[model samples]
Target: MLVLVFGYLFGGAMTVPGGGDYREFLLPGMFAMTMLFGLESTVLAVTADTARGVTDRFRSLPIASSAVLGGRAVADVIDSTLRLVVVLLCGLVVGWRWHDGLGAAAAAVALLLLLRFAFIWVGVYLGLLLKTPESAAMVQILVWPVGFLSNAFVAPETMPAPLALIAEWNPMSATAAAARERFGNPGWGEQSWAAQHAVAMAVGWPVLLSAVFIPLSLRRYRHLSR
Candidate 1:
């Protein structure tokens, strides 16, 4: 609710330091960022289970270790999809619309869900590695920096050179930028490769994250002793 309100109020009051339609540009970015919030659901679930010895009890069972993680993944996807519906309705209430055809809109939805899927593995891995629920909770602070460093609420070029470079290349930026393009919303009028190739990067970021985190998470899950 706070995020949706900030997107509407801030997007309404601020221009992109240029002539771009801030609210329209901001809506898709907010959509992508909102999907990322599912990280907490996965993290907290895993950490609480571990802290309560539920995971240890599951580990002692005869079932495959993969089933535990699979159950969490399935539940998270179902919950995230429901939450996405609410966020989409909120976006519509704020005057955000996709001008593109249904195919493009569907593609945007896939990318957003894929991004959430990839982040789930990341949170799972973190939860398995952390010593306590408190430590796992602290990991959430990393999400704020990760979300803000991207071109979600502002154009990367507007930042200082060092920060701008980081922002332009942030994986979240690709998904948000791709979302704006696919949704036919206003975008930064830049011609850089990152700006021009948002869709590919967005697709690649999730794939890369999943590739790296899946094995790590499963391995950590199997190593319950660690």
Candidate 2:
């Protein structure tokens, strides 16, 4: 809500290049942002379990190792879905409407959830790796740069050419651009390859991240005994 308030307060002065309502552009990015922020909570949750020896207890049970991590992933995804819904409602209340059909809007939402799911593994790995709950603060601090470095609050075009390229390639940027495309909202619409193929990049980024992180998480989980 604080982000929304600040966004609106400053949004009036911003203009989306290629012409579209800033709120419309901002809201989709906000959806992606909400999902990105979930990384912090997931890290904290897993870290807390590790700190309290809850994970150790689970490891002692005769359950499949995968279940331990899977359970956490399930709960986080549910929480992320609820967060997404609340943000959607808030976006509506604030006058950000999707121009696309319901089908497109639903697809956009699916993409958002997928992004969250991928990040969950990242959080899980980090949680297992960090020695203490206090260390989760590192991930929290890192989230902001990841969130803002994208085309979430402002278009990448407004950034320096090199920085804009990096932002355009950011997973968050791809998701935001893809979500905007799905909602029939405006985007940076830059000529860069990433900007032109937002949906592909959006889908690809998460899948790729998961591919790398899922194994790392499982490996890390297995080696916790070490």
Candidate 3:
């Protein structure tokens, strides 16, 4: 909420050349940013469980192995959804609107949650690999830079060619672009192929990230007792 308020206060004043309203562009990106921020919570939760030996205790229980991770995934999704709702309501209060109507808007939200879900798997893998809440604290330093380097705060076109290319290809940028288009918000009128087909990338990136991390997380979990 504070981030959103601060983003609106500062970012809403800026506009991409030939783009629509800055606030319109800012909101969808903020939504994507908020979802990405869930990475921190998931990382901390998994790390804390490991650091405190809660995971070892869980493994010793008679419960299904999948239940432990499944429960964490479910809980994270619910928590992320609640956070998204709060952001959405705050967005409305600050004059943000979805011009794409109900179905598209719903799809945009589903994409945000999907992004959150994939990041949980990444967090799970990282937390177990680090094996310490102290090392997991470093994830914060990495996450914020990745978040800011995308289109969440400014148009990629405003960046230099190299930086712009990186931003354009960023997974978060794909999702943010897709959400903005879904919500009928402003875009930087990117001419590149990636920018033109953002929704596909938005969906594909999360699936790819999850496919990579889920098996790794599961394998890591199974090997933890070794």
Model 1, global lDDT = 0.84
Residue range 56-121, candidate 1, lDDT tens digits: 999999988778888888788888888888888898897778889989988888888888889988
Q: Between 1 and 2, whose TM-score is larger?
A: 2
lDDT of 2 at 224: 90
Q: Write the per-residue lDDT of candidate 3 for residues 129-149, one digit (tens) a residue.
A: 888888888998878877988
**RMSD versus native structure for model 2:** 1.3
For every candidate in turn, the CA RMSD to the true structure comes to: 1.8, 1.3, 1.6
**Residue 52 displacement in candidate 3 (angstroms):** 1.8
- Model 3 scores a C-alpha lDDT of 0.86
Better-scoring candidate (TM-score), 1 or 3:
3
Q: Supply the global lDDT for candidate 2.
A: 0.90
Which run of 10 residues does model 3 get worst, by summed lDDT?
Answer: 3-12
Off by over 4 Å in 2: 7-13
Candidates, ranked, TM-score: 2, 3, 1
Which residue pairs clash in candidate 1?
Answer: none
Work out the TM-score per prediction: 0.93, 0.96, 0.94
* Candidate whose lDDT is highest: 2
- Note the Cα lDDT for every prediction shown: 0.84, 0.90, 0.86
